[model samples]
Target: MTAVPQPTAALLDGTALARELTARTAESAAELRRRTGTAPCLATVLVGADPASVTYVRMKQNSCAKAGIESRHVALPAEISTAGLVDAVTALSEDPAVHGILLQHPVGAHIDERAAFEAIAPGKDVDGVTTASFAAMSFGLPGFVSCTPGGIMRLLDAYDVELSGRHAVVVGRSPILGKPAGMLLLARDATVTYCHSRTADLRAHLREADLVVAAVGRPRFIRGEDLKPGVVVVDAGYNEGNVGDVDFDSAAARASLITPVPGGVGPMTIAVLLEQTVEAAWRQLVS
Candidate 1:
């Protein structure tokens, strides 16, 4: 008897895709600057000294430099009051020199994250954390998207994963990742189901999903056995030890396409951020 060929999943290769997108963004930035003599500028608001957040902000700044976009950083004390932080962010929102605004997450236990996000002007909300941006993404209007979710969409399109009429399960409901991701997929004509910490029968949802997005911030929480064979997986988790929310090996074995943790969603987030920054600057010139 002839042996059947064993199926192996294809890696989505987000890092390579991200590089392509970033190169395009660089070209766009250069053209925009050449025409108007105004380079796109992104203002980063960091409220604390958390190592991870600090590193992320630095990475974004470095990317901006490479793309010929200027980065202005605003650092606030970790113990600052909510009102103070909001005021600080509001100042950046009102600044004419800034095209995009990014406020790093997990600022402090005492500060209200939503309020800080709201302080960012919707026009400059490149990070897409505000209600205005969320509404735009949900309604299929032209506006900035949540960076990580936006990056995931780019990855999906780059790989040509069909979303129309597909059942997509988003495992998590955070404002930045899960909620926006489901909305984006739904806008593409996919049926989206959102799962959170309190979700019951999570495995049942996985079984029905044609596309699965793991962004619950857990380390390898989703196992391979739960994945429906041939499912497309986008794991957006970046936890301790460079782990992802979905177990990569198991899911990759079962999935037809899956994104790697380190090279996947992480790189795409910065790419989206840079792209939007340039767009925001161009918009201001015409407006």
Candidate 2:
């Protein structure tokens, strides 16, 4: 008899799921527009001319158009002071025409990122970067979630992955991504453990995880050897050259379900953003 190779893990196809979600959001947007003459508007704030940031903003704008949402952009010079950035964001928050506000991350080292984020009204913080939003998410209250973390949960649900009472190890602690991810998992009754760069004995944690969320922003930081068999992996990192935080090939070999880099978490993030923008608009325009 010929030898047969063991099957690899199933792909968590975020692209297909995102398309479905976007279509649903577009329908809601159209209905909202039919009821009221105004369409949903999302304001995007970009600082400097960073290539990666520019590309991300463009992608989001394009997605907005497809989903029947209007996009307003504010471009600030690289040398803009923290107070100046805050003033710009505050203006958007006060604008009745803008339903949701998205401030691109890493504005500048010289700028007060937190202050700029705080300037966005709690209701208009569609990107979910404000402390209010974070608190809401942590407490499982009704609020917009951080986009990438929201996407990860949707992906897990789409595949029918069980989270309750399972050990979920998140291998990063970014305010928006990793921290919120762990909290969301915890809300679902999953036992959550967070590990960061300075954490001691990282592999030991991975060995026990039933679910692993890789958001460390390092390419191939988590190896297959570290993961126990049949674990679920969500690679939320997008590094240079389209690589993810996990070594996909190696991790897939061990994982029962895994998300790919470009097609996995990327599309879902935009989908969730568009969804939240339309929802925000509906709230502001309808009731």
Error of 1 at 142 (Å): 1.8
- Compute each candidate's TM-score over C-alphas: 0.96, 0.97
Q: Give the TM-score of candidate 2.
A: 0.97
Model 1 lDDT tens row, 4-79: 4344789888899888989999999999989989999999999979999999999999999998899999998899
lDDT of 1 at 221: 93
Task: Give the top-scoring candidate (lDDT).
Answer: 2
Candidate 1: give the clashing pairs: none
- Residue 134's lDDT within candidate 2 is 95
Report the lDDT of model 1 for residue 147.
Answer: 95
Cα RMSD of predicted structure 2: 2.2
Clashing pairs in 2: none
The regions of model 2 sitting more than 4 angstroms off are 1-7
Q: Which ten residues in a row have the lowest lDDT in candidate 2?
A: 2-11
lDDT, candidates in the order shown: 0.92, 0.94
